[model samples]
Target: MKLHELHINDFKFFSQVEGDSPLLKIDGNHLLVYGENGSGKSTIYWALYTLLECSFKKSDDEVRKYFKKTGDESLVNIHATGTNNTYVKTILKDALGNPKTYRVSRKSSDMSIRANTDIRESNMASDFINYRVLFKLHSSKHSNKNNLWNWFLEEVFPYVKKSSDPCLIEFEALKEGPTKFLDLNGNQLFPTASLQDAPSDEEKIFYRNYRDYKQKWVTWHFWLETFLTNITTRANDLINHDFKYNFKIGLNIIKKFPTFQATDDKIKWTDPEIIISITEYEGIQNPAIKKPHTFLNEAKWSAIGLSLRFAILETRLYTADLKILVIDDMILSLDMCNRDVLLDIILNNYVNDYQIILLTHDRFFYELAKSKIAQNGIANWKYLEMFEDSSGTFPKPLIIEKTNQISKVWQLYHGKEFSMAANCLRKATEKLCNAYLSRQERINVNYSVKNLHEMLEAFRTKGMANGLNQNNLIKLIEYKNRILNPSSHYDIETPLFETELKRAIETIEALSIEANINV
Candidate 1:
């Protein structure tokens, strides 16, 4: 399903974002949201989570616990006045182009949810990903009791529970054998009667059944090991796909691909407990007597864990006609190179099919993604800025214009804000250089001053190779040296005035047009 809009009212930092139409309209099933810390980015994430709960018929208590808050009062806006109910209403479109609205609301102490018009349950929760869920999976503190692994397995391979193994049949029979002949006192009277001396015909029959039960018990023990072994194989197959993908893309950081296995050889027939052991290639090759956790660094482990989650989601949700993928600051642990690869994977592989809502606090990553998405021909993708105010938090759409930065620089310079205008001019230059480099598919430049120079050189080389006017190149280099470089460093003593700043801005603007990098 595609989310057309979401209306959040008094749920968290957002007090009321109302509209005659949808408040947060999604144009092309792709949204890139940028917000600083505590800017209610996570509020939007959880608001969507709440809406998903409503769709899935999750209980109020469960939702409250998930939010880690007590009572409906904690969920309401702290600034809310009397009788203003807090709610999150989500509007989505199904594969048939039918509109569906789901709303979750909270009052003083009451919570209620209204699902699709028919109030049908949904199983779409598996499509959502947030930091908390990922961190739990990546955390090394978890043991065999981790519920995240269990949920992952169930969601990714729901058909596993339907396996009709003969061993499972025998195990079930062994469990129900005693209960099939329980007496009024809840005792296995048949087994007890079998031990009596002068046993009657009924006692003889009980003895025979008891012997059969004992034989089945022994058989179940033997088969249980085989059942667990089969399950282990399936789990490895699923995890190995993720491991290979992660290791392949994260090769710069991780030297070798890791292997994962269940920690225990035997598993319970019901509610099996599983803990994973990640063995590094070196450890496996060298046959080390070390613990699994000692084999990799934190970053590598995080990559493996996060990639496993993505692999599970991709394997399961790739076939769904309508899917929403919510990613919240999941690339923090990844390096720049891997981040680019991850973005490429998302856009090329998933963006066309799924509605992806990505949230990030990193402005560099946000800008990089904006450029990448635009380059991928996703014209209608919306970029939003989330920030807090005295009243509450709000989301403002960031319009992408060809000359947005240069125009701002001109405005500021005309308004006599020379310092700020010079800064804007420097930023515009950096953006222009990056945009040009990106157009040429040179996306490996890191977000650093040194790399910015490399971008400038690369852009200049490409422009000149394309027969760009030498005068424009000279003007670009002059602006970079006199304005951009000095403005970026306080230690540099390059004089800046209104005339020079205006000339710098004009030079960059002209070069932007001449190089065909305006967009």
Candidate 2:
């Protein structure tokens, strides 16, 4: 289930926060979260984790260290001195086509959790997937056989197999290579083929430990038991979940250039460009591998240097279409060309998903996502900035002073024409908002305010529909790529100043006049 509106209160780093996780209502996809450092970007992720009661390997220390509240009376923390309870509310649409709003309070003590799962919205989309967020920070939830795993599991690790739906993949071994593959049922994965070589130490240890892991046991390992069953069921349920997740393309050098294999190289260049092709793809099965049949490399992790050079690699995998992916501090070792390739994947190939949340301190990428959204429209994103506050606390999220990346870009321009450029663009945005409002006034919808965010939700809806002009979309894409590849045209002192200045003035005037009529 995708979250619509979220409210975080009294959580570590976040004293209070609220925002509409605005979505492309028509498809209920492409949600843009706008925030800067410490503004509660991670908090939003945590709120879900807390509600799901998901455990993690690192969660034990993090919760005791940060999630613990400040002199929180609601929390009874005998061990940690600073423990506070945070109230997290998430608006979700459940399976069985029901709108649901879930809220729960989290404390240092696991026993103090409370959840409200019945506040389902009357209206919900038909394809909304039922997702039970069962996460444990630094917890053993996934290790148990019968417990929960991450929300996406369809077509995941081939070992995982399930036939209830097309998406669920049970993890039974296909080839009995050295290690035996066990299915969810008490059956061997493959026809028990004999292996030529003996298993390695790590493999033996894993086999021994995983073999006895009581995934569904409700005994001493009660939490693990529940966690295992929960994940198994959820993963199976999402197999046929309506909205599938996938990436449009994977990482590679071809991404840097729209054309194929323009870069000349032999070994590293052979690496195929990866696209998260959806269930809707009409192209060949393997977009990256040009040869007849391809082999998937399941070897050990390669050095970061080599991996970065390889073309088209999927960093993560999922059963459904992955609309929004959050990559934190990755791609540090990539060269300029590789970096460009990655950004290109995010922008052009990954077109189906509207919103992309890339967590990077790299100013280059931040602007890239912003530029795309700005060129597209503010409705396409919410720029969330996270940072630490006065107390040097864990971190607090800072609200993006500038909603659209255009304004942010304007503020960043320091060269001769840069300052003036932002002013001109600012004027253009003001005009568009007015035009959008005016256009939205004429359309009407039969749905109530239930899923439709507001009494005037249809206005925003219609505006969004009308604002998505073919020409505008293409132009904005060019603008976004311009920021990424600063060619001669993007020269700060370019000769387009006069035309730009005139356009800004005309747009501002036209918008002002139009807004007056709307008023």
Candidate 3:
């Protein structure tokens, strides 16, 4: 699943962030939410977790204090924010390119739970006061769990209902059955809250229609055993359906696979060096294997994180119906080769399947994403910039791009050695340099959005042969204003922008590949 856009209000540091946009335009399978440790980048992540009711193993109490009760008193209330009555609306694109929205809002004080009032919304509102509004929600937002479950069973995948299909199915195979989720359902599926009573008319219209209520959600687990093979996982006896907990393999193998026992309350994947490849658990270990999610040892650190995250983002953005991705600088840990390899994976594998949202403190990561899409003539991707100013109410995210240095640099970074991207940038640098060399010959009066817009427009009047297509040229020029001004999802009636973006990316990538660049 991928997130196209998110709107958060009255939640922690984000007092009323409605127009926040991502830093780059993406139509791939992965989404990354990049930020420094204290930038509230994860807040966007938590908002989704809260709405979906999924429990992240990492959140601590300090993060919880920022989510609770302070706002509205109405029948239908979301977690009450300390900031005025708040609203959070998340836009998602599904597997088939359909879009839907989910929103949670709370009224300001003197709460109510009358017959005319909806208790569920009130409870959600009450949860606001309790602290940290977590979701564990129906598969999607905007609606209730029951309806969602029904649709999943009747439409998306009915097999998810049985313990064998909807639940993670494991067989008693092998001399030592390594725990495996075959029929394979794990992260792909999850559980929801058991509601007590149906809500009032208004609530029923929204909440009752939710599919997560009576139904279950499922997906395959992420990690695999690298050090040990021919292993076995236990049965569903110890698994928790609602929260989607997995068997703690490292501890289970060491302590209790044969009646596995654990030595610690907290558990995590054991291999520190093992990289994850979402394409498959069985084939990735071999270097000869070819899959969408192949384990890779080579990538450029300056660009790898962006590549890996974007690969999945591009997939979801262009293909899936529900698009929401939350990444916390997952690529910050790699080197340059790994980064380049990662970018190739994204452009080649994930873009046709999802929508992506990402964050990064690294300018390198941002530039790499843009460069890959833009140089290839991709128009679907957009760049979002984040900053904090005391003069503002809270931290804000802005969408900005031009000459698209960020995108251009990102493209230059692919397959780039330590300073290769920086080196290639000399050509663009020469554009600036030659201008300086000839500054004495003739000149312009000033530098600003006004003059910049005028120049791009004048260039557009001359047409495609001079620079870009009409639409592409216009989008490039209007990019910054669109991000700063804010627009509704209603405005973009088609993922066509995203689709066109992906095809452009593919087109450019083909260029590199045709010339033997190994994209």
lDDT of 1 by residue, 247-297 (tens): 221110111111211222222234333334433353243244233434455
Lowest lDDT 10-residue stretch of candidate 1: 249-258
Number of colliding residue pairs in each model: 1, 79, 118
Question: How good is model 2 by TM-score?
Answer: 0.35
Top-TM-score structure, candidate number: 1
Sort by TM-score, top down from the best: 1, 3, 2
Rank by lDDT (best first): 1, 2, 3
Model 3 C-alpha lDDT versus the unseen true structure: 0.34
lDDT by residue (tens digit), candidate 2, 431-456: 34444454334333643222212312
Candidate 3 segments exceeding 4 Å error: 1-4, 17-42, 53-66, 69-83, 92-99, 105-320, 375-379, 393-519
lDDT of candidate 2 at residue 284, scale 0 to 100:
43
In candidate 1, which residue ranges exceed 4 Å CA deviation? Answer: 19-21, 58-73, 94-98, 107-122, 141-272, 278-290, 315-322, 390-519
lDDT by residue (tens digit), candidate 3, 401-502: 333332453442332211322332333323322332234322255532223334334434543454434555455344323221223222333454334333
Provide TM-scores for the models: 0.56, 0.35, 0.38
RMSD of 3: 20.3
Deviation in angstroms for 323 in model 3? 3.7
